[model samples]
Target: MAGTGGSNPSSAAAAPKILLAKPALVTAAKYNRGPGGGGGPDDSNRSRLPSVAFLNLLSDSWDFHTDRFLPFLTDNTDFTVVGVIGPPGVGKSTIMNEIYGFDATSSGMLPPFAIESAETKSLAKHCTVGIEPRITSERIILLDTQPVFSPSVLADMIRSDGSSTISVFGNESLPAELAHELMSIQLGVLLTSICHIVLVVSEGVHDNNMWRLMATVDLLKHNLPDPSSLSLSHPQSSDKEIKDKIQEAGEEYMASPVFVHTKLHERDSAPGYHVQVKKALNQYFSSTSFNKPSVDGGSDPTPLDLYFIPCKSNSEYQYESYYSSFWKLRDQVLSMSGPSFSRTVSERDWLKNSGKIWELVKGSSTISDYCRTLQNSGLFKR
Candidate 1:
C-alpha cells in the first residue's frame, strides 16, 4: 500500500486544451438563466433540457449520495456501469468524458466530466473529489473516482494528532495514512462488485502500483456479494444456506477489468514494446478470474484487455494518434459483452443494492485484518 509517484506526468499532457470545459460554471449558468430570470423562449427550453453535468455519487466523506442520482436512472434493465480508478492527475476524468460522448466543440455545452485545467494542474490539485456519476443518452453510467494514493487526499483526512478525520473503519481509530490505504482498496472492491466494466488506469508503463493494488483487492475481496445478488425476501433460507449463497456469489463474480496505460512516449508505442506489455499483463493476472475463458466454452482463454494510449504531442505514431486511440477505446468498451448478473435487476434496484454493497465494503473484516497486519509491520505511523 505504499505510495507511488510524487507527481503525475499524465495530467500534464493527457487532455487537449480544446476539451477544457468548466462544468461548474456551465451548471450554475443554467440555473441562473431559468424561467424566473428574464429570458426568451429558446432560453427557457434550453434550461429545461437535461443538464450535461456530473453528480457526486460518492461524497468526499465516504458517504454515498443515492437520492440525487436516482432521478437520472430509469427501471431499464439494459444498462452498463463503467468505473475508472488510478492515482491523481492520471486523466481519469478526461477518459470518462470521451466515453460519455461530450461534444467539446459546441459552445455553452459542458463535458459530462470536467478535465483538469492548466491552472488546476499548476496549483497541484485534482479535479474529481469522489465518485462522480454521469448517465449517457445510451443509458451507460460512468463513474469517475478521486485518485488513489493521493497525498492531497491524505492531507485532507489526517488530523493534527495523526488520527484519521473520517471514520472509514467504523468504531476503530486508525492512522490517517492507514485509513487512506484501506480507502483505495474499498473503492476497488466496491467498483468490482457493482460495475460491469472497471477501467484500471496507470500513468505510464513503468508504474505498476495500481496493478499491485488490484491484486491485493482480489485477495481481500472475500464473501462480498455483488449488487445483483441482493434480495428483499429470503424467509425460508437457513443461516448456512445464506452463507453458502454469499460464498458462491463472491467466488463467481468479478468485474471485467480493462487495463489502460496512458501518457505513453513514442518509444513505448512501438509494436515490440506493446506486445511485451500485453504479455506481462497476461502473466501478472493469469491466475485471477480476469483471464477466464468465455462462458460459451471457448477453448482459448480471453486475452487481457490491455490498451496503450500515447501522449498527444507524439506525432511520430500517426497510426495510433491520441484522439483516435481514445475513440477506439470508447467503442470497444461499449461493445464488450461483459459478464452479466445471475438474474435481471432494474436500474433503481441496482443503485439501491450498490449502497448496501458499499456498507459491506466499509465493514469488511478481511480488509480490517489486513490493516492490522500493516500496522503491526510499522510501515505507516499510527
Candidate 2:
C-alpha cells in the first residue's frame, strides 16, 4: 500500500506522468532547439531553418574547427566557394555580406558577416579573428577571413621578446612580423586551392600590397592540390604523385580571381583613371596564371577581372554611384561560371578535404624555408 501523499516506488518507476508544453516554432530564430519529444512535425520544421549566421572555421590560434559548420552543408556538389582577403577597414566582410544576399534594411536580421562599425574603427580593432564561413540558401559558401597585415593581429601574436605567440612553424620560433607575412601567404594559398572564386580586395587604387601578396602566393603554392584531389587513404603520397595530379588537372590550377579595388575617391572613378588602373592591373598579373587566356577561346589575350568600387561618401559625384558599382559587382560575380574542381565533390567532403589542405599549408616546407631565409636576412628579429 502507498503512503498518504506519496506514490509507491514501483508504480512510479513503471509509469511516470510528465507534462510537455506545446512545441514552439524553432524556425523563427537561428540556433534554436526543437522540442524534447522525438519524431514530430516540430523536428522537421527545426531542420529546415537556416544555419547560424557565421561560424569560425579557423580560430585566432590558426586551429581548424569543422563540427559546428559541417551540419549546415548539404551533399550539394554544384555549389561554389567564394573567399575574400584584404586589410582591415577595407570592407571585406561588408562585401561578403553583400554577396551573401543579406537584406540590410530588414529589422532584426543580423548580417552573415559583421561590418566594421564606427565604434570598432575608433578602437582600432579588427572585426574578424580568423576565417568565418557562411552558406546561403542557394548553397554558395562564403568565407570571410581576418584582415591580413593587420597590426592588431600582429600584436596579439607577438610575445614580449618579439617571437610568435603561436607555434605554427613546428618547434622553430618565428618573429611575429615574419609569421604575420607567412600567415597572409598561407591564407592566399588555401583560398586559391579550395575556392572556385577568390576576391582579392584592396582598399585604394594605389595600395598594391594585396597584389604583391598574391604574386608571392602564386610563386610558393607549388604542388598544393585542391580539395577534390585530396584523398584520405593516400595521405602520405609522394611529391611526384602530387605533382602529377596537379599536372593532370591542368598546367596549374588557380581559382579565378576578381580584383576588387574599393573606397576610390571621385577622381579615381574618372573614365581615364579607370582605364589606367585596368591597364596597370593587366601588366601586374601578366605573367601569372591569373592572366591566362580562357579555355573557351574568349577574345581577350590577357583577360583582366577587375572591379573598382567608389566611396559611398562620394555618391554625390557624377560618376558611377557606390550602390551602382556594388550592384554591378553582384550581378557579374553571380553570373560568372568560374573554374571548377577536377572531380565532383559534395560540400561535406569539400570541407573535410579543406581541413587536410590547411594542414599541408601549415606544414609546408617551402614556407618554412622562406621563414628561415627572412630570419637570416635580419629583416625581422628572431
What TM-score does each of the candidates earn? Answer: 0.84, 0.86
Any residue pairs clashing in model 1, and if so which? none
Off by over 4 Å in 2: 1-54, 230-233, 294-300
Weakest lDDT window of 10 consecutive positions for candidate 1: 11-20
| Model 1 segments more than 4 A misplaced | 1-23, 28-54, 232-242, 247-250, 294-300
lDDT of 2: 0.74
| lDDT (Cα, tens digit) per residue for candidate 2, span 1-382 | 1001222333222211111111121223432212222222354544653334335788657877777567556555667888999999888987887876766886655666778888988988888877877665445678888899899889889998888987777666788898888888899999998898899999889999999999988888887887778543388887678788888777666888899999999878888888898898888888877887766898666567889898988739678889888888888778877777777777777898888888888888887787788889999985
The global C-alpha lDDT for each of the candidates, from Candidate 1 onward, is 0.73, 0.74
Top TM-score hit: 2
Native RMSD of candidate 1 (Å): 9.1
